[model samples]
Target: MARAYNFAPGPAALPESVLKQAQADMLEWGDAGASIVEMSHRGPEFMAVATRAEADLRTLLAVPDEYAVLFLQGGATTQQALIALNFAAPGDTVDYVVSGHWGRTALRQLTPAVAVNVAASGEADGFRTIPARETWRLTPGAAYVHITANETIHGVEFRPAWGAPAPDTGDVPLFADFSSSIASEPIDISRYGLIYAGAQKNLGPVGLSVVVVRRDLLERAGQPRADIFNYASHLANDSMLNTPPTWNWYLAGLVFRWMLDQGGTSEFDRRSDEKAGLLYAAIDGSGGFYRNDVAHEVRSRMNVPFFLTDPALDADFLAGAREAGLIGLKGHRVLGGMRASIYNAMPVEGVRALVAYMQDFQQRRG
Candidate 1:
């Protein structure tokens, strides 16, 4: 079968060109006479891959010289625990703004380790809206403020429509999980103290993650931890504390290069807006045939979760979508609906195809 438009939340769709290059390199990478996965992390060939990946990522995100970038194994969930260990003392209070499922998960990762003050939460309203900024009760001397930049499952985000793309937290530094939305637009990296994303979504394949942190935060006297869990140690050893996921790193490097060639974040910002607008318009105009419960202003551009008016038709909808060259439209288990995750790799044509299919489905079934 031909390649279908993929919309899985993570381990999500990658650019076709990146996949083709990786396929060719899988047998032998450059003149190394070995597959990238078989090469030593300490070897010059893989070392170059690691170096170029980080450098290209820094350039892609416009990371400041004052910050350090680490390409680590695992996903954003691992970083959740490590961030607390690296940035907060044992008794320190940490402020968290819970907007969606991932935001709640972030709180669980740091419990008992730190004093967590949920500054704001939208759970009371079923996570359909973000609490107004003024209503947040922030801690005065908290360790840091944390927020999920975009919620992949709940279909909510800290969008410009809600207020600032990045919220203001006064003196406390801001930390964000941008797992699903990173590189979809131009971000003011200076405004954030730390930003993390699992590569599977927007960056590349699975088994790798990217963390951008302000250098000064690394010096904090955090709680006792092993050298492997220390962000500073990971940085000191150049993110090669142990055997790194070289294949994922190499694949991500190819993706970064593809993004640069496609005109970087500014261009993606435009494409994201175009694709999301098209999809949302179709949902809103469905005249109750389709519904997305998320508040309009805070709707996620990356993940669009909506429901068919009749729950019984859910299975049929997905089956038809797959038959029409559309896949990954099934919603997360927690939500029990449909979600379209249109990340950077998804073209506007894909969204267009999805919208057309939806219209046809409604005509046939509605």
Candidate 2:
């Protein structure tokens, strides 16, 4: 059977070439007489893998020297509580931007510990729009201001506007949950104090969450830190404070190499823009047969959610898409419709195939 194009939000599609390389190296990696998964994290061979992965990622994103890239075990969800635990004391407040389901979920985990101030919210509008940065009610002396740069569930993105100076948050740092949009575009690493992303979406496989944090922020995380979740501990031991996920780390290294081969983040941004444009154009030209609710300015290039005018044909449409080798087009259960997650690994040809399928489906159904 032929492989279908996968569009799942997290644990999404990976490049075919990367998978082929992994397969070839699975039993014997670089003539080491052992698989990467069998090697100890502290060994010279594995250390080289870790080092090269970090170097490639740093070059790809232009990560500053002041920031430490931590290959952590926890998913992005773990960072929510960990961030609160590390930064905010029992009575300290943190500013959160409520964008969509993931952002709200992050707040829920943090609320049990810290005082959360909703700096800006698009909840009232059903998360169809992103609140302007000027409208955020940032708390004075807040621990940090957090935003989900792209909300996967809502298909909303917060792109930095050109020629705009950074927002004045006094001494409070900016932390972004860039899980869905990490390598999908080029981000100015200097502008954010902490950026965390689950590797499953655009970077690599699951079980690894990459955290790029300014060194100063780790030093400033008040004492009485949890042993496992402490950023300082991970930094002090070079992400090997405990046994790391060796296999995930190895695969992540491959993904970093793949991204570099594909022309880095700038190329990713261009490809994502082109893919999104094709799909969005299809929806717009559908003559009310398909509708996308996300506001124009903040539309996500990674996840595109749309609803069919005739809800009764939803199942048929999805079944037809699957039959045509365009899989994972069904939207989240909470938002009953269709979502096409075109991550960095998804080829432009895949998006074009999807668009053609949608057009053919719409015409036949109509």
Candidate 3:
């Protein structure tokens, strides 16, 4: 059978060209005559791969010289702990803008380690919109302000225009968990003190977290941090503190190159917005047949979550979708609805296929 349209949120779809290149290079990368998985992290072959991947990403994102991009083993959940550990001393107030599920998770990870001030929260709004920054109750001299750039589970995104630190947040540095949104669009990296993303979403396979920290923040991490868990340690060693995730790293490099070849981040921004509009229109056009409650201004261009008007048709919808070559549309268990995560690699055609499937399902079942 032909490849299906896959919308799994992470370990998400990758560019076909990148996968093809990996297939050809799997056994013999360059002249090394060894699979990237078999190569030494310290060896020259993988070093070149590591170097180029970071370079391409830097170029694609326009990451400044003042920042250090470290690819480490822990996913964003680990970075949640690392960010709090590295930034705040015990009992220091840390401000968090809770917008959705992941935002709450990041806040919880910091609770036992720091005095967390809920700067802003949208839970009362059902995770449908971001609380306006002006409304935030920021503590003076808070260690840092953290926000989730995109809430994958809730289908809400803190868009570029809304990504700045709260006005009263003062000189407190800003950090973002861009796990699902990184590389989906261009960003003003200068506004953020640090940014992190798990590679599985838009970058590549899992097992790697891309941590881009402003060089100055490296000094703030408290001592007594294990070398392996230390961002500074990873920065100093160029992310080779121990054996890295070799194959995933190499595959990510290919993905970065693919983005550059496809006209960099701006092009991606246009395509992402375009694809999301297509799917959202389908939901809206269905009248009461389907629904997505996320506010229009902050709806995620990367993940689209919707519910069938008749919940009874949920299983039948997914089953029919799979037969029609549309997969991974099941909603997160917490949300109890259907979600479509159209990451950077999901082509316009795949989204069109999904929209068509939705229209057909509604015609049959509505």
Candidate 4:
């Protein structure tokens, strides 16, 4: 069967070309006589793969020389907990601006080793909007100010319409969770002290994540932790202090090459806007049949969550979507509706197909 237009969130659709390359390399990689995944992490073959992935990513994001990039095992959540352990000491305050579910999750990962000050939160607005930057109550000597660059589930992002793409934190450095939005556009990496993302969303496959941090931050005498949990140690060992996720790292390298060939982040930026515009227009034009409660200005360009006029129609909607060669439209249980996660891998044609399906569904069931 042909691949349907997938709209699932993380571990989302990968570029067909990347998958095909992986397929070709699966049984044997290069002249190494073993699969890339079967090779030792410290061996030349896998090391070259890991090294190129980071270099290509740096080029793709225009990462600065002062920043160190590490491709580590686990998802963004692991890094969330590690951030405090590596950057903040006991009693050091860390300010957080919670915009959505993942933002709240970031707070949960912290140990009592550090004090947390929630500078701003959109929960009061049901996460339909991001609180204004001016209203934030930043701490005087916080380790860093944290923000979720985009909320994959809540369908909210720090769009230009909201304010600066990266909020100003003054003397305190800015750290952002770009798990679902990384590589979707050109970002001024200098504005952020640290940027991290799970590879599953826009980068590549699952079980791997990327962390880019200023070298100075790695010098901080963070709280006591194992070398394995230390960012500096990970950097010292080139993110191979332990057994790395070789397969995921290799696949991510292929994706970085693909993105660069396809015109890097700028091209994806245009494609994302076009795809999201088409999808949102269909929802906004659906009369009362479809609704996205997110404030228009802050609606996510990556994840678009919308509700049906009748919640009862959700099952039929999903069923019909599957029959129409579309899937992964079911929304998270927190807010039962539907979400179309149009990450970098989702083409404009897919969004067009989705829009057509929505219009047809409305005509039949509205």
Candidate 5:
């Protein structure tokens, strides 16, 4: 019973070392007599845990002094409406460039409540490409411009580093959904007014979303933000305004430490490129046997989605993958193809193993 290479997106793979640490310390955490799961979020033990987790994350991302990192309870989806509430007033508009599924989800959730302006949309291209920056129709007097830094479902990514000097955001703040791309590489956090990422993807586990917001934006929150959904409140209370997701918070801390031990985000960036490069090279070299729909320029280095020439072989392909100790090759139901989510936790060995299995699968069933 060896471990299988997992390719599932988001509640995806975690570093094995982190899991083992959790396992070894499950029954007793330090001198606390109680496990992390059993500790009070308000107590010194868990508070120190929370504080270190935040500090380590700040170091890992090189977050600026002006930004407050709030470890929140809900996933990124919750941030959509909350962001709208916190940033855009009733009559003021919120602009978005809807590149994929989660971007559209944000659009839908923010509409009606706040005026929604789609600055650009890739839906016309079937979400296979990112709409170029020059073509965007930015709204005047908009609260902020939002972009999904990486579209996990569509395999499209706009690396924050790739778009420095700010991409003509036009005096408004730039807010990015970094859920799938967070910590995958070095980013200029100072360019963004806010960033929200679900911990499940590249961070650690589910149940907590890390939000980094500039101090000024917290001060300028749109009127009538509910207490729980308010950024200012969360920062004021130190993200423990109420009971936070204690265990998930603890596990995320383990992951942050692991990232530091592995040489921070730059190392992860290299590993991600190496891993995803192997997969995409395999797909591109298959001589039309395997094809990916994404445009070359904006193709995701994190989520690699490909389709086989003969759709009829998809099931056999997946079954073969599983037998070869590869798992979660099934594509999203809406997309109907294969997606290999090679996040920070997925090793070079896993991607290489996948490429090897893919070569065998293609030969047998091509």
Candidate 6:
């Protein structure tokens, strides 16, 4: 069967060329006579792969020298708890800007460790928009201010505005959960003290999460810890404290290389905007047949969720989309609509196809 244009949220889609290269090199990676997955994480061959992957990512994102990039596991969910464990002590307060389901989940993880002040929330608007920065009430002396840059389920993104003062936390650091938006745009690394994401969305497969933290934050973590959840330990050991996910790391390296060939993060930002524009245009031009709920300024460029005016047509629309070679158009159960996740691997052509299909579907159903 031919490859389908996949739009699943995470573990979503990868470049076909990368997949082909992996298949070709599965038996022996460069005369090593062993699959990359079979190699020891401490060995030299695998070390080279790990180093190159980190280097490529650093260059791609322009990560600064002050930041320590650690490839850890447990996905972004673990980081939700780990952030509280590492940064906020008992009785310390932290600020969380609630945008959507993921933000709520992240805050839920920290409830046992600290007082989480919801600085701002769009829940009153049904998670369709972001609260303006001016509306946030940040607590002074808080440990950190946390925000999910892009909420995958709600299709809302908080774009960093230039020339603005950082959020008021009174010596607190800024942390971002960039699981759905990493690599989709050029971010100001200096503005954030810590940034983490699960690699499944835009980087690699599951089982690996990337953590970018400033060196100063490591000092604040205090004492030596033995558990895998300890960020300081992972940083001290160069993210190989234990047996790492060798296969996922190898695949992530291929993705890094692919992104470089495709012109790095700036190019990615441009293409992402273009793809999103194409899809949003389809929804906007559909008259009353289709609608997107996200506020214009905060709409996600990676995940585009929309709904047919008639909710009863949801199943038929998804089935038709699949038959037309567009897979994973079904929205999350919580959202109960159609979501088209056009991540990094989704080509502009795929978006064009989806838009054309949307037009056809609208005309037929009208």
Q: Taking the tens digit of each residue's C-alpha lDDT, what string does model 2 give over 1-366?
A: 988999888789988988998999899879899998899899999999999999999998899999999999979998877887877777788999888999999888874557789998999999999788789999989889898888899998885552111344667898889899897777788888888999999988999999999988876655366588798889899899999998888888899999999899989989988999999999999999999999988889999999999899999999999999999888998798999999999999999999999899988998
Candidate 6 residue lDDT tens string, 136-220: 9989888889988889999998764521223444467899899988998888788888999999999988889999998888766
Where model 1 places Cα greater than 4 Å from the true spot, the runs are 161-164
lDDT, candidate 3, 1-366, per-residue tens: 788999999878888899899999988877777788898998888888899999999999899999999999979999998887887877788888998999999876764757888889999989999988779988888888898989999998877556422233458888899999998888888888889999999999999889999999899855356777788888889898888898999999999999999998899999998999999999988888999999998899999999999899999999999999999889999898899999989999999999888998888888
- What's the number of clashes in each of the models? 0, 0, 0, 0, 0, 0
Model 5 lDDT tens row, 64-96: 999999999989999877888888877898899
**Model 4 ranges with Cα > 4 A deviation:** 161-164
Model 3 alpha-carbon miss at residue 283, Å? 0.8
Residue 276, model 4: lDDT of 94
Q: Which 10 consecutive residues of model 6 have the lowest summed lDDT?
A: 160-169
Find the candidate with the highest lDDT and give its number. 4
Task: For model 6, state the Cα shift of residue 350 in Å.
Answer: 0.2
What is the per-residue lDDT of model 4 for residues 1-366, given as tens digits with 9 covering 90 to 100?
A: 999999999789999999999999999999889998899999888888888998999999999999999999999999999999999988899999999999999999999989999999999989999998899999998999999999999999999754337988889999999999999999988999999999999999999999999999999988999989999999999998999889999999999999999999999999999999999999989997999999988989999999999999999999999999999989998888999999999999999999999999999988
Q: Is candidate 1 or candidate 3 better by TM-score?
A: 1
Worst 10 residues of 1 by lDDT: 159-168
In order of appearance, the predictions have TM-scores of 0.98, 0.97, 0.97, 0.99, 0.97, 0.96
Q: Of models 1 and 6, which has the larger TM-score?
A: 1
